[model samples]
Target: MSLSLKRFAVLLLALTPALIAARTEPAATLAPEANQAVTARMVYGLLSDSRYAYAPRQLDAALEEDILRRYIEALDREKLFFVASDIARFEGYAGKLAEAIKGAGLEPAYDIFNVYVQRVGERVAFARGLLDAGFDFTQDDEWRYGREEAPWAADTAELDALWTKSVKNDWLRLKLAGRDDEQIRTTLDKRYANLERRVRELRSDDAFQVFMNAYAGALDPHTSYLNPRAADNFMQAMSLSLEGIGAVLQRQEEYVVIREIVPGGPAGRSGQLQVGDRIAAVGQGRNGAMTDVVGWRIDEVVQLIRGRKGTDVRIEYLPADAGVDAPPRQVVITRDRVRMEEQAAKSKVLEIEDRRIGVIELPTFYLDFEGRRTNAADYASATRDVARILEQFKADGVDGVVMDLRSNGGGSLNEAIELTGLFIEQGPVVQVRDASKRTAVHGDSSGAVAWEGPLAVLVNRASASASEIFAAAIQDYGRGLVIGEQTFGKGTVQTLVDLDRFARNENQRFGQLKVTVQEFFRISGGSTQHRGVVPDISFPVTLDASEYGESTYDNALPYTEIQAVPYQRLGDFSALLPELDARHRARAAEDLEFRWFSEDVAKFRAERARKTVSLNEAERRADRARDEAQREQRQAERRAAGLALDEGAFDDDGLQADERNVVQDVARQKAAEDRPDPLLRESAAILVDAVDLLAADEGRLAARVLRPGRTSTVWAGGADR
Candidate 1:
């Protein structure tokens, strides 16, 4: 009976495909069924009243034009589905979406999305038909894997050829992976079917969210709209469910992009994934057949990823830092629950010659806001944990400190100020200004200094938000030397608003809107919005800032500066940077580890510069072999030198890759602990040089330590908290 039913269903799909599509139905059904008009008005009203909004106003003709362009781009980012005629048709709605939204009408958004849905069905069908015939890979050809910047197809004929090549490329990838023709065909058939099926599954709410994000994202990339399910997922994460890979995924084009890696999670701990990487496919267990997830809804992909603890889930992802045309890499992650303890600030003392430099590795700036508000004595927070670590460091007779904020995606604003207070007695930490120029200076008022010795703050591309606040404050006060690559430029603040609260229907779930409300600046008068914090002693920047950072967004808030607040300088660290930099460069030149790292980065960048890949099976095999050889060679050299190899977290000995072993997890942590951190070691060495430099200069450090910062006109909430 089941086989008969399946056959009947296939016959039904083949005969009446239009019945499955909403666009072919009556026009009234095409419009959103929910209260999108009310929701859109509520969003606009909130942004309009906010003084810090970068793009709040009655939607003018210019904004309308931008919205229309953005809306279409969101629908077809790769320009594969939409042809010239389709875009030409959409241009008629240009500069008019504002009036439609203002009048509580969303038909225009629906119209565009309906067309996109139809186009996706057409493309998926085209791809499936091409797959049946297969391709002769004997002919030499190249597939343009990167097409975000490609021009739209002039006609359907142009689109057909593009899809032909695309499908051919897909077949070649599987064939090279050693799959039989029958297996490859089955996988491709399922993938194409899923693509079309998921598009059919999309509802009015999904379409509304996409349109709303396009509207909000025009002003700033961080501003976005979350549907009811998405909002619930976000709240669950905030409450710390800690299941799955524990990464925040956002939709971009057809892919689910990694936005943030949750601290203490398998993904963050293993470093197998990074922000901006897009998940292309997912599979279960150690070697389950991969299911193509491209164009699947964000929530659906997430559902596939969420699984039982200690089980393996394989993820195929396009790495963010890997340049265009890079092949997707597969990783098998053993799921584990994230413990809050792992996210807490940790400290260890590094012995450099005759002195001890305390290193505090802060994975994130976490604070239990409700706990703190209720005066819970044991509320978990970054500042409190770091304060305790500092006390321990003092007891250990540590000469200097390194606040390692590497990969520290920031948290509470109040915790940043409190954390800054640990090093400096009292001073302005950050300056925030609104749209109409209402500025508020947040500072630390506590008359307590945890560590007054020479300090260095280690940062990288991932350090952001509150991390920037502390690092910038330390730099402004001359309290510490900011070391490593430039910090992630994300100095904007956002407030989440529940749209349902303002809706007339109490039962209607209008979802949530995350709007940018304020942009903060360093106390030294520069905003870390686009131009992140530059280090006093610089390291070779491995991640390209243009590809990462806030600058990558289309209309991110521009970097600006306000008045510098009054803050006492700790010492003349700037005056000594020249010599300090000189000494750092000299030492790094001869350092074997640093040289190896630099060489690796150079090779990676060179590979990333390519634009296309050969479709020939032989060439593709050679490429994969070369990549594997390079990776194995690096691990071999590290093993030879008795260094730790980055084999990910769950490199199980006896059990399958998917099976969880608590004992193995502990062992892996031990191995990681013993791994030599070349960057931290170098930072400690620099701090040692600074300690000696100050001591030799006779009371320079002492004089710098004596000066305490003065009070400032602070904000209402942050400084005190």
Candidate 2:
């Protein structure tokens, strides 16, 4: 139901049996369909040992089939804002699938088609019902493809089909806005014809996605299979820029749909190109003849439009309207690279009530791989830049700093150690354990301490890998405070092994598996595996906790405790915890709607736990009714709390106000417990308090300041990965 990465990953892997059948039961009930287990030894032997043959490990057909089945089942588990009836229909297809997989002949496909047609009929009926019920699905943000890369070119037809389906889906949401059944049916008829023609011309999403899997799986999973044009676009994405009018386009039937005009780029600068416009024709330069691009492969169409920077490219487009009477418009745009500067790390100083705290939002720890190959600065450059910003903040006398690592996917491992070292005097940053149980402790070999201030590491459901390691180490060493949601529970380390290294011939191509070998552990005792790196201070943000952690993944390793390493505490901040708790409670009480939402979400969970799918039409209708009733009950409760009774009300945009409230709440809590945070207000306050305590105890700070390591020179024997 939720689109958490953990849930989607399970869906992507498709290795869980229950996922294949739209069931949530344990896999033991299904036949023992697992492939031979992928072991650390097998992976290692393939990489390091020479005894093994240079071949990808082979699996039996049954196992491969099981993998696909499980993968599909897993995808269905996320609920993904799919219409409940569509979901029911999808499950209904599973029966036909089971029969088809077990049996043979056109009779199976014919029977499946009968069920499929009925499902389509039901879809049309439900679309009308939603219209009658006053729902507006199209406007729902969930309809937008969330944060994934643009779909490649082979998927043009699929994209078109989705656009067509989305039109109907969106109409259903709109229909819920007090429309009569007559009007609804009329709208549905138009949508049905559009969808029918589009669907017939395009491949089914299931088949298309399956083909994608095979194609991508053939290469390295990271190296995707894009159509010739999507391939060009993919190259641009890697370079962090793109040319050709700077508009993200998609193929919708005969139309090349404009998804978004890149902000500040050519199309954006043109002040004419708009999102949701379709290019029916294109012309190069100012005087070239207009070439009809309708039905052309998206790439061929793009070539017709692309030209030198600052050169004009004309696009003949129709505005995105399902209505037939809309006229086409011509717009001219120049070509330029769209720079993604927004994704770069940004710094700000927050005046949290009385406390002044510095916040560094690290979106992603990115390293320019190409730049690094050319011996240009990499993550080190970014870190150095951030350090300069921190130094400036220090000069401004901010109390503490919050390194906002939320949603930060990992980058260079080298940077992780270096960043950790920046805050502490030379010591082991993290202890990495390998398959042989050999412990390798990576230390801050750099003797300099760039920042010695009180630190607060902020993370959430999306914080992962290097983020987890750094947070865990800081918590373990008592160097900083970890605030906000738990870090993503990905404790395993992956080493990219070139599959070609073991390939038997020039054409010996095999996909690489990002095999997990070593696991990470806190210096204290715990491994951030299934349990993840839990914050010392916990705050609730999202309702779908079960949807986002290592526990949600079937193949994830379990958490365990390790022997604690002896490490010095940075300073004592534990005394402030009680006051911090009190302040948080006081702030949470003022947010009445947030409180009500929490209660309603709990009820939704209970409802979800009680739901089951069946094939009978009457039973399915009853289930739909139950779901609608539950939704109505939730709405009534929200209305009682004085919240608006809008259908698509609980959106991220609406949630921003609540997020601000929560931020304010946190600010208050931090202020109550500590001084103004440049790194961590609570930590700084604790530092101030410690300064007083140490002064009273007679100059302990001078005695505890760590000295440099015994030796600083590098050895001739080896270099690190």
Candidate 3:
């Protein structure tokens, strides 16, 4: 029997809840709306359909068990709430979730959430009580902070013991930060209260989205469900013009953490805000009192941070890994639209050993989708801007060009092909494989070459999806040298399906689902799925490939190969690679900036590898003191080297020394904009090496520059000659 049909049959035969229920209904039931039921049905129907990239796995008892486990994990990722007894009680419904969803019965999911909320309330109350009692800093007891892989507590007594240690840790952090008893109590009371309030505020839709996403995520990490409000937020994010501080926020425990800073956005250019920083409070204008946001909903916090364009929004944040009692720092950002100028392709000329090399930093493969559909002539795109940059480079008589795609998370797929077309005359860029195994080749038909000169593409671990496509095409065609670390290996394409479209009623509002529909492969027959494009020349990076790429995701599609598409190759770069690598290595070893970067990366990796933190108050204080001393020493070194120190270089308080110093702000921005990027500089040097190598090999050099009317010098799929 078909999996869907069997699933339906199982649901019909197993509608009884007697096996799991101790009561007739949950203590607090926030029932799903009728529209939500319809939405759930539609979502399941779509996933089971042939359009999804992966084949539909049978939603039988075993799959249902997996979904239930995933849902629980999503709700309490760190095993902070819900004891072993709670988990055991929920397991009765593990194999029955498929049946429940089949009949649109969402009470089980809501019941679990209701219990989670109650648990959170109880824990927060206990934490508040402990805060009042204070902690003994001299105690030698340790706290295992990393609990994601740990088991749940056995009972309330066990949970109480855990909460005691957790609360004590928080107290110790504040005590070390030099807070007196009353001050620590005040801060922690508000934090716990916010947590309780946020948990109590969870609506039916929030629970539903969380549970449904668990189901979708089990199939693929990239596939997700977004509720109506979240759907709107997603669209706004894609538009890249939100009137906010321009940082994506997520709730992490009691804090709203900065997930990503939108490029070209206020926070992106600020040089103060960073990913993983916790937003503790937000205020309006220059003089508004900051309101603490700990334990607040992400959307509510976002509303507080967002403002009208050009208006100032003040933010107070705790640096990532900064102890709970670490003084919060504040920054004032003038909210503005995240326009193309911030994310657009930017050009700079670098003089490498008397040869002028042009560098274009492409932050993302962005395109104005709405404008293009409306046929707006002024529409902006990465390819168009890059073409202009190449023209300017030609006019300036540059020897070579470096396309920097470092830290580029990728965007429009069409732009990737278009950008690749600017380097090669005409060829296939990537191939798309759908659910049914049918493959369609996407190629660049534009015959015009933008810059037929020496080209090198620089990428890093964050460079993903569309970035991978462009880099792969360049390497495949021998059109350019791919440099830096391996790409992020996200080769799948997702299509957002609005649930409202499939609803029966016109007035009914349903959420959206971002479903993975296709996987991309390089024209050379290799899939960039879990094995991102390997660089021809590698650079050292601190980020572990296993921890950061598509491989990190459970059930990610494996890498494979297909028949190679026919296309012309530019020239052989094999002989040139050795000379290039040797020169680059020697230069990197001798460069002070590179040495500093290497040391910083090593330190970062070492810190990340430490899963357990010293919980002893004295040890932690000593460590913090040592770190502060080192930071001051670094500042002194920078001063000695004649570099200007940041205004907050030595401030213990979170507030900037001069909040309204417009001149200093502008100077800092300019300095950041004009700062020499070590990686980019190295890439340009590598391109110069390529130029010199080609200059010596006249025959191979002629092959690159003297291409005759898109003729094939080498087969696209075959080994390079």
Candidate 4:
């Protein structure tokens, strides 16, 4: 039981024959395979000794308490299964994890989880019985769905009452989804059984993964522990077939949440799959019975999801904006390989009357590393693709350009920097601060400018990482106007370390650690950690920043700043914002599309704030009818205005088209072209306003970067359009 750093796998957990796809009942005993103290010591040593972590600290009494608290919260999210007595009984483990880890004395993690399993088993049986008792949907009662912040129940009686409502809520959801009483009974009964089975099937390795993750999460939300079995399963899946409903899944509390949707993938093509949506159940084909994956291990969930191409997979999910009490909506995605072309930067011109505003849609900051290394002539690079588009825009004599980054979850860091370089002639783009307090300036030294025209960068809550870097660089240098919602505030960089690399014994398997090693900063010095790049002129957004962005994570890093770097200032968007905002607001108020978008956003915002739902059948049905009528009314308006197809066969506000029907596709595409995006048009309008404003006051405008001794200003011609 030595706490030596050299024995990296000293705390490896005993494994069962379960290869992640099986759900057999566990054998009698769950035991440890190696020394926890030695493994903990090694893992901590790597963390503390890293030259990059934000602030790796010792496992002192204070940190130990936080770790224990995090572990408890992870096990009993929503405070459902655990009673006040259970938590009180585990209080002795508080401020004791550090000592226990160092001395190989920690038994509290397993003990608490064991208690959790028993509690879940009891709750499951009670919930199943509640279904048999039958729910009275006629009652005008409200069911409280979210209880993450609620205090633990004082006694089992209180817990039973809570479970009763929870079970009722479940039954009501199924009924709303069109299930009959018998069908709802059977479905809910199976769901409860699955929950119980999942809890009982928690292997020793699964416990270790959860406990270590709690420690990591106490430090920062981005920090994580990836168990070896899960990693192996993913690798095997990737090798076997590159087919699936392409959505990145991550374990959050008891549910698996969608982290990102791969462009051109089945999930993205379906358009219903969204980032932050929680997966409740999964099924194969069109009508297969869904297997409850609420509390299943991530690998098991993955095994069910990734399958052969052209296969239909139904995913029942809680919408990103919906509360836990909301009825689950399912989407059937036909799985296929992701097409890289769909992810590349593409261009279009919004020709409204006399103005031709060039728009470039960059879904991600992509770079073909292999092609670049091999010097492949046809390789795809965001910078290169965008540069080409800018050249075309110039050739077409466009008025302004909008770099659309909405829903663009970032990719390559180098691409962000290089893309930033395209607009600015040779300057620092972003800065990186390592754990050792060493700052490195990463910039573009290409000494070339792609486009010097009036520019605007559009962003949203889903625009993160590399997207933030690009938008922040553009905003910091006054290079462009950042418009729309504040970006996803993910500024830290992480690297995965395989523990097996340090293990002396081949059989001793440790997991992998994803450590946050650095932070991203704009050239202007502000880190885009928790506080993302705020839009210069904002648009109406339904997503609450506190609930949707990095701020949602309790352990996200704080915003900080370093010394500013030297860069030439372009035109000042701040000075023109007052007039620009006034005009924009006036236009938005008058525009029918903008008004409708705002109305929808308002409705979603209201729905998001609802913590409880009416159980009354009449009330629920009335609400449903009202919502449907509203949607139908909007559809009618679109048809009346010729914004929709003449046949009225298309919905989705003319945003999506049926590719299979060529005639309908062309009509829908035409309708889509006719239907202008309010935000994008507004952004282009702002950029145009900036151009005019700059022309009115040339003294404040520096459209071209002037070198110390070079005064050609040749790039200034890009603004002439």
Candidate 5:
């Protein structure tokens, strides 16, 4: 229970686990050789449990040492302008860490670089060793680290050379710490004296957990492996209510890169933050001093950014395309409570073909977990509000509705069921099965139908989780038309478990675990695991086609199907497919924006296919030319959307009136045109056809209901149910 250890836990949790993956459960018990202290034992158990699922090969002690040495050397060689004095100060911290680990019988510092204890220590060191041995590490190499061509080697000479260099570096580092060369060398020799004793006292479970953590992190940001203990901790995922900055930050290369900004998040509202912005520093409150964040871990940086709602957080950012020497600017933003209203489905009217088409963009099925626990408004309440909006659109005489679930990651299973119910008349939404094989079916209990009009769902590469389920159900039930890019393929469900739930002391902090428990299947019996929910009609969008979907991920499960349940269809809307397709094609061909998009896709396709890059200066110049062409194409896209053409004007300094004016003009023009979104125009025309068919089919029931003797009494005000 030291201050640093507590800080470590807080910061560690801040680091998001790599993307989801299928993994074997790790051992649950603590290692036999774990430290006697409860906290140390918890750390030891986690490291050895394999629950954290660190990549074993990469996190070996020897590997970590090597990687650490190389990373440190790189930092020094780059001369990031760190003075010699700073090195001494850094070494002082390292010395203290080593001492603490020894006194506590914890193997904290495994390598000279920041790859301290846990699984990363070994993998990074081994990779560095390979590099030092004059081995070629290329894409083709079998090993995760090192050149693909020379992935594995049986000889020890090269590896030995690397270890020798690492040892010399360690010695030199110690010498510079005000220790005489002899004393430094002696200390180094003495450092190994207790190695055997420490190893014997080390817990195997801790080692295993550390291994899992390292391995899992190497994948993408969402995948992870959980041990049984951790799995059990997250039975009821707690929802917290807080205003989020609305930006997705990830560790990319050596920097924390902004992946995407939620359209209405505080960050998104400010319009200063964008995908690919690099955060270099953060300042607290209004007028707080900025703290430099270079070389800091992703989680640590996140901790600094999170605070009480209604507070101001100042961020310093460098644009993605900025040069190494480019200066960054500060953006002071006020954080607010992020609620469903901010991240939920927002409606707009798009006129494409002289028809007013209703466009509802759903960001996520987010239910405030913390609020729900405290009996606050839930996802169902938010969906009800969205339903009200949809009704208003219906009353407004909109042609059709576009339910856009482009980048939604999903939240709240109950909300998913309720939302589905809002679209479809009383039916089962989804089925959930526990580990013991018991099944629970969730249904639409309200019998409330929101809008039964023509519907088109828009999705893309980033859409996943509940997004897939809703889209699949809609497609399976023939309730709507799916358009746009392919959906992200994730059909699995995860349960987050807190390890400390069953352990002693919550603050003892064993950490929490998220484990896959069940897989979702469509009513038609098909699983949206690897294949995802395919759009009925696909659109040519961005180059993300190559960069998205579960198919491109490693260790992804295969798609499967079960026997589909029979549900009577209230009506059919597919009869107008031919007319809809033809109309859409014609509109797209004539629209300048669509034409621009088509051309850009074609030009980028050719460039994206070139995998090899020439090292020659002349050839490099050709590459630059290709890149510039791509940029120009993007610029033209902005103009097509009625945006400002000045590149410098888009910088983080501030927004220009021209930019805002262009955006407003585009929206206003689209509004005035009053064209049904070509996509929805076709949907409306089909719905109108369905209305005709319903009238034709009602020959018997209509006759009976309209009979003078069997007239139904109409109440002035009544509840049908």
Candidate 6:
């Protein structure tokens, strides 16, 4: 049977009785607003429309089960709030979700959420009571950190027992950090109170977003429903500009943790804030009392932090690795707009063994959409900046170039095509496959070639979407050698649909949905979907591919291929692979920095593999002590080796610390900024090897044919050089 017919049959078999019961019985008392009802209907209409990638698939029993599971997981990811009994009760509506969505009957979702809220309240009260009873730190015990895979509690008694251990663990952590009983009590009380307050503040819009996203995510990971506030945030992120500190924040348990520091933002410029740091409190202006924000909603915290361009916002953050008892440091940042300059491509020259290699580090493939539409001459874009940098490199007589796309999450598909155009003459760059299986080829019409010197593209696991497109194109044509880890597999295209567009009333705010509508493919027939653009040369894998990337998503599209498009084979690097590999291996074996990096990756893997941590106070203390000692020893070794040490490496008493010379501080910062990056240096060395290989007789045919500004004619089989 056809897939759609099979789905329809399954839907009828599973949902017929549920739909009948739903119509006969009164709808559960959710008290959903008129706007929310309109929003739900609009979202369902869009998902079912032919414009979406998954529109061909019906809302069958299988999809209903996925939506049900996704909604439950969204509510209690850690299995801490709801019990197995609650899950069983919700499972009754598992096959009925499709019907509910069609009829705009979101009561089942709201009902499940209400139960989760009630459970959270109960758990909070139980946890608060446990704080008064002092924990026995001497007891030998362990606490599982991430309990997402663990089964839910069987009963209230079991849940209380779990909370007892959790509370004890928290107390032990603080106590090990040298916190007194009174201080520990105060902190725990405040944390619990804040959590309760935040939960209470959850609005209907928030619940709608969570539930709708659960439904959308059943189709694809990238598909999501954003509330009004979240929609605004999404728009700001896409524009690469926002009036705030420019740091990505995520809520972890009760703490707001800094996920990334946007380059050129106030927080990025401060040089004090770091990823994984927890924000404890926020203060307005300079003298406003710090408002504890430990359990505040991420959006609320963001609103509190953002202000007028010139206003000051002070943040109290605890360093990632700092002890619980360690006092939080206050950082006052004058808020400003995060501009294009911050996210633009930057270039530098690296002199490696008499080879002057120009390196362009592209943070993101950003473009000033407004400027482009206005036909502004100074329109900022990755392609424009990169072209200018290439011109500079050519004028300076650089031998080779490296395009560093490491940690670039990707942006602007147009920029990716334009950037790729700077290397290859007019040809098919990427192919787009839509919902109906109709394929469209997107080629660069401009035949302009920028600096086509011996090139290398540096990528890591974080390099995704447009980054994958560019890297795949370059590698497909054999124009450049891809280095580092594989790119993040995110080949699907998303189009944001404003829910307000479908609304009948102008004042109604229905938010938006970022729906996945298309998938991209390389000219070489391979799809950079679940399997990303693999580097020609692989590095020591820092991130486990199984735990990260598109492959990690259960519903991610499978890897596929199509007939190869006709294009010129620029050069054959296959002959030089063995020699280059041997050279890199030899150098890596002797490189201290490489050894250190490999060891770090190994340590991280080991740590991630462990499911539980010792809750026993003595064992925990011993672990912390060993970690600290190793860190200090490493710092000492680096200092002894004449390498620059981190500013935090040295310990200093507050006494006379302020007497330090400003000039000396500035010099130290400059030296640290100029410190050599071991990975980039290695990549440059590899490029140098490529240059040498190209100079050899065996590679002469390929090298002579693949010259800068040379255009090849398309032959019957392929392009002829």
Query: What is the lDDT of every predicted structure here?
Result: 0.74, 0.50, 0.74, 0.73, 0.50, 0.75
- List the lowest-lDDT window of 10 residues for candidate 3: 1-10
User: lDDT: which is higher, 3 or 4?
Assistant: 3
lDDT digits (tens) for residues 228-298 of candidate 6: 88987766655556678878777654677786677778999989998778899999999999999976778
**TM-scores for the candidates:** 0.74, 0.59, 0.77, 0.73, 0.54, 0.78
Residues 544-647 of candidate 4: C-alpha lDDT, one tens digit per residue: 67679898987788888899888775545555688889988998888766787798788766755676767787887777667667667767887777774223
The RMSD of every model to the true structure, in order and in angstroms, is: 11.0, 13.3, 10.8, 11.1, 15.4, 11.2
TM-score quality measure for candidate 6: 0.78
Per-residue error (Å), model 3, residue 589? 1.8
Candidate 5 global CA lDDT score? 0.50
Regions of candidate 3 where Cα sits further than 4 Å from its true position: 1-29, 139-142, 168-181, 242-358, 392-399, 504-508, 628-676, 696-721
For model 4, give the RMSD to the true fold.
Answer: 11.1
Tens-place lDDT digits, model 1, residues 440-534: 99888888888767688999988988889889988887777899999889989876677777565576378888888788998889999888898
Pairwise lDDT winner, candidates 2 and 5? 5
Error of 2 at 607 (Å): 6.3
Question: Could you give the candidate ranking by lDDT, starting with the highest?
Answer: 6, 3, 1, 4, 5, 2
Candidate 5's C-alpha runs over 4 A off are 1-211, 214-342, 377-385, 436-438, 541-547, 615-721
lDDT of 3 by residue, 497-539 (tens): 8777766446538888888888889998998888898999998
Error of 4 at 523 (Å): 1.5
Candidate 6: what lDDT?
A: 0.75
Backbone clash total for model 1 is 1
Tens digit per residue, CA lDDT, model 2, 407-498: 78665555667777767777777777776666777768667776665567887778887888888877766666677677778776655443
lDDT of 5 at 578: 57
Candidate 2: lDDT over CA atoms? 0.50
Model 1, CA-based lDDT: 0.74
